[model samples]
Target: MNSLLILALILFGFTSFYFGKSRIKKVTEKGDLRPKALPHFYGYYQALWCALPAFLIIAIWTVFEPIILKNLIENKIQISSLNEISQDELNLIYSQIISFSQGNFSGQVTKGIEAGAITYKNLLSISQGAKVSLFFCTIIAASLFAFRQINKNVHAREGVEKTLTIILFLSSVAAILTTIGIIFSLLFETIQFFTKINPLDFFFGLGWSPQKAFISDPTNLTPQEAKDLKEAFGAVPLFAGTAFIAFIAMCVAVPIGLYSGIYLAEYATSKQRKWGKPIIEILAGVPTVVYGFFAALTVGPFFRVIGDSIGLEVSSESALAAGLVMGVMIIPFVSSLSDDVINAVPQSLREGSYAMGATKSETIKKVIFPAALPGIVGSILLAVSRAIGETMIVVMAAGLAANLTINPLEATTTITTQIVMILVGDQEFTSAKTQSAFALGLTLFVLTLILNFIALRIVKKYREKYD
Candidate 1:
């Protein structure tokens, strides 16, 4: 039933879009020159006009229907002389109604709940049916109206074009609003975190032990005892661990990924890419969870033996093991994106340089690489973002100890690891530890946004040079 409604909506939208466009075309071609915008633009305008309003209504209706309907039904049930019920009883009735309506409840249904379920079903049917019919009617009518408006001196094409421009503007605004919503959610939660934990302690404190915070005691600590909690919330070690891992991962991934990317884009024969590309992409499809145990059990202990031979200390869960594995994980991310960007660099520039007696390597370094630098940098930043956001490798191989030291043999933690630890056990939502997760998440998100913005700016400036 739900699938049928969705199909009906899609058909209604498609029909309105095409039929509206054709109507404009027919009217404009009938010795009328000034059609409002292009015929295609008129179609787009009509389709958006028809679809957006109804879809938005449907979306909003879906979100609030339960709450609104439940309230109305609850009030009706409470006032009934047929009932002697408490708030909890009314709530139970509401639950049963919802469950039964959704085809979830199986036992014999009560009269009030059964009636409410019927009403719920009726409301869903009416809303969905009305949306489809209303949009269809609106589109058909609007198309006819637009067609009638088209005449010899009507300037129909311009009107259609203007409407299309508005549609595009609205779409862009919607995207921006969504981004703003995400940022606000992160920001608000971070604020809650700061309220519970000292901002300075979270940011500047040197001891980094969050798991200890979770190691609950039966006796709640006094205020003075809690003041000592600052000793455990060290940002320094976590920051160092994160940087060390990222740097090591980059050490392995960067040269290999960049060279592979350059080869695929600039040097590879078509046949080499036929198998190589898919083979490389296959690496990305492996689950991170699979990589987790591989890093922890295999690489961690393997590195331990190597370090023992070399007379260097190596913890079973060392930063090196995790970083190396993570680098291998992100190689495709670096290679694939860089390959496309490098390929996009103008062939004319490369040919011109080669014609000037520049060696292949010289042309690549002085011309091709410079031209593709912005895109390459963008890809690297994206990889960095991915590395920073990665959780599984660190959680498994990079043992969680918020120790403020960078020695790879010593245990260390990451912001993500801290979040997982703080929130893992029975967390008190109002506690400083739980809220710290939000603060870390916000910081990560903001850093990624900054990197992305810089990358885009570099790419844009580079584009202007050629364009």
Candidate 2:
């Protein structure tokens, strides 16, 4: 019903646009007066009037209809059941009623449930009908008002522009608010988690076993059970693993990516660059899961074979395998951005360096590079962030055991991988085990934020010196 109403509203808007345009044309032909705005602006003004109010009404109704229905259903249940159920049980019953009304329920039905489902279905039908009727009335009234206002002196352009500006502003606000909402949600959950586990143990403890914290009821743990339960939230291992892997990825990505960028920007023939750059950047389009599969199935085994030949024991799932695949994935990010920044360096600088008898390599090192240092730094920072946030490659190639080691040949895990592990099943949000994911997430967020701040400071310092 809602979809059909939206379709009707769209058709009405298009019709209004034509009529508004024709009205302006006819008025100008009959009188010597010129329109205050273009015929198209008048058309847009009328179309917006026809569509926007109806769209708003539909949005409001969709948001409130379920809430109103839920209350009505709960009231009916309370009167019928004598309010014998707890809130949780009531919610479960409501869910069953909703499922049955939608013809998706598989559970055994009782008389109460069947009656509730019938009531819900009837209410939904009435609500949908009213919603459609109200939407059509709104569109019709707004269209008539806009048509009457369409005259030689109407400020159609101003109205249209103002409406568009408000829309864009609201869009920007929505994005910012969404980010704030995510941050605050993580913060709130992290606080809940910390209340159950000590913040110091979570941050500084060396152990990473969250399974020990699992309890059916946290409030009723016996002293021995609490003592036997070694809730090791020591996140140092996860942090160490994340840093070690990112460091390895940067080591692999930076030199090769920078050299490739330089060759493309300065030395590669036009034909070579035209083909080579796109092929190099194609790495970025390859899904990270594919990289994970390649790392797990192929690279990890090949490394094990070579390590065995050299009498060095390498784990089947090692940080080296994940880091190598991740580095390859990040190469395009570095190379593409660095190439653009290097090419952006002024030609005059290269010309002057050449005139001063500097070779191409020396000119690039001393002149062009310094001029483009800020942009190069920015590109590297972006690549580092990409490496740090990666999860799939690490989870597939790097083992989940949080082995706090610097050796790339050993198995290790990262914060992201562990978060995935912690949240993989049915989670009770109040349990310390499930809440630890939020804590890990909050810590990762802080680390990323700090990295960005430090990068910005470095970029600003260098930019000031260079510019």
Candidate 3:
């Protein structure tokens, strides 16, 4: 029914556009006066008037229809059952009614649910019918009003442009507001987490055994229970592991990705580029879960075998294996962005370098690299962010033991891996264990934001020098 209403609206809008253009053309043909705008602008103005209000109404109805329907069904159930149902039981009854309406009810049906289902079905039918009727009425009224205004002196172009400008401005504002909303949500939860766990202990303590603080009810704990909880939320180890793994990944990715990008941009034949670039980019398209599997099943075992051959103790799940696979996964990000940035360097710079009797290598090293340094740095920073946020590969290849060792052969955990572990199963939101995930997430967000800010400053400084 909704799809049919949308189709009708679209057809009406198109028809209005055609009739509006024809009306203006006929008016100009019969009279000596000309229109204030072109025929197409008038057509667009009529089409917008026909479509925008109906679209807004449909969107608003879609958002609120389920809430209104659920309330109506709940009221019917309460009155029919004489208010004997508890809130949880009512919720279950609502679920059963919905299931029955969808023909997927697996539970035994009761009289109250049957009556609720009937009420729900009737309400849904009426709501859909009213929606279709109101939408059509809105379309007809708006089209007629717009059609009457499509006379010789109507400034259709100005109206259409102003409408489009307002739309663009609203879109930008929506994006900014969404970002602000996410930050505030994380901030609120982090504050709640810190209230339960001391900020100094969380930040500076050496242990991270969240299981000690895992209680079913956080609010009812006695003072001794809280004191004996042995909660150690020290994040230094996770930060160290994250930085170490990212460093290993950058070590593997930067040289290879930069060299491949330079080769593709400067030296590769057209056929080589056509075949090679896609093959490199295919790494990025592979699912992270698949990479996790590859890390666990293949890379980890292979590293263990090599380590045993040399009589070195090597865990099957180690930071080295995860970092290696993550580096392979991140290669395409670096290579593709670097390739585009290198290609963006002006040809004149290369020509000038060549005219100075410089070799190809010298021209690239001195001229092209310098000119593209800002973009190259930007791409590397993006790759660093990607590595920092990766969770699955680290979980599969690097064990979730928050070891503070610097050795890559030892099992270590990252902030992302710990976040996943802390919130994996059923969790009480008020528990210190669960809220710690929010704190870790907020820290990661701030770290990335700071890294980006520093990267921008560095890029700006170099960009000014080069320009």
Candidate 4:
């Protein structure tokens, strides 16, 4: 079935290419008027016209196929036994029926199961077959349509190129829609979680613990479960932890990355850049997992030992280890982006400063740095986001105690770490624990979005001055 779909897609591309090339030739040779676009534009136009709508149909079909197929099976399966089942129970039965249909059922298949399985198998087979058939139909139709318009005397090139420009615009719009869809999905899930828990308690509570209030075992939950599960899921610890870790990381990273970027951009000769740049970037290439172990086994323990010697109390897992290591990891982010922004400043501007008898340091600090401030701010915001969302480093090195206190030596957990803890390994999505992950995810998303917005606004405001 996959092979058939691939074949149809190949035919779609081949026919469009042929028709477009043929149209361009006819316009160039037979038409008296000069062509408005190059021959390749015609090919691109027809290829896009033929492929886009058909591809969208395929993509949409693939996303909703499983749900639609399940419903169609429920309708077609002649078993009256499923009629009395609730939606959840029916969904469970449907899942098993699907497993059976796919020839991977673990249990004995009764007659009713066999009948439903057969229907589901037939539906899946027919739906996929229809996709392949429709793909070929769209190809043949679009190819013939393009070919017919590209007669021996038609102006096919101009018409096709104009169409291609519109197609390109449409493709960009799709990205905007996809972003909207993602935001809405996150918002919906967050609303559901908040409905189960008080928003105020979740946001402002200082308890900083989730494991304490979660009805860990659903089987053991009483007949009547208490509502307002949000009170149990406090964001204070996660929020404080995220801010504290990011603050520590920025403390470690910003000065070093900023000074190095300044030196590289303004002071370093070409020879210095040739060797030093890659060495700096090598730090970025090291895997986060390796950093995780370094944080867990080496840095955290090392800090604890150091703290003990200094008469300070340090936990086995300290925020200092994760934040410090994360800071090192993101240094390349700061340096590389800052370097670009600094380089973007016009040499003419620098020369103007020098002509005014400004010392090099004075000129750089006053003229060059101010000119590139926007880019530097943009890079810092991006690094802030990286620090906030970073998981592996904090998860291993910073303990998941959700301690709301702000001691670097004490154990703490971030939103990302809690999300990981809640969803990792075995998870039951119906529980508050699992829902809290989504809530945390929504919070993380909102935080990043706001940070990015501020960064973009600052960059834009600065860009206007330079422009």
lDDT of 2 by residue, 1-467 (tens): 77887898889989999989888888777886799899998999999999999999998998999999998998889888754767788789999999998899999999989999999999999998898888889988998888878864588999999999999999999999999999999999999887777788888888888877766665677996565344468899999999999999999999999999999999999999999999999999999999999999999999999999999999999999999989999999889999999999989889989999999999999898888888888889999999999999999999899899999999999999999999998888888888889999999999989998998898777663433
Name the 10 consecutive residues with the lowest summed lDDT in model 2.
224-233
Instruction: Tell me each candidate's TM-score.
Output: 0.74, 0.91, 0.87, 0.84
The TM-score between candidate 2 and the true structure equals: 0.91
Tens digits of lDDT, candidate 1, 78-181: 77646588888888888888899999998788787788888877776776676667655755565555545543335545665676688799999999999999
User: In angstroms, how far off is 39's CA in candidate 1?
Assistant: 5.9
Error of 4 at 255 (Å): 1.5
Best by lDDT: 2
Error of 4 at 309 (Å): 5.9
User: How does candidate 4 fare on TM-score?
Assistant: 0.84
Residues 385-439 of candidate 3: C-alpha lDDT, one tens digit per residue: 9999999999999999989889988899999999999889888788778888999
lDDT of 4 by residue, 224-306 (tens): 44432434677888899999999999998898899999999989999998787889999889999999999999998998899
Candidate 4, position 15, lDDT = 71
The numbered model that scores best in TM-score is 2
Clashes of 4: 1
For model 4, name the residue pairs that clash: 197-230
Question: Candidate 3: worst 10 consecutive residues by lDDT?
Answer: 223-232
lDDT (Cα atoms) of all candidates against the true structure: 0.76, 0.90, 0.88, 0.80
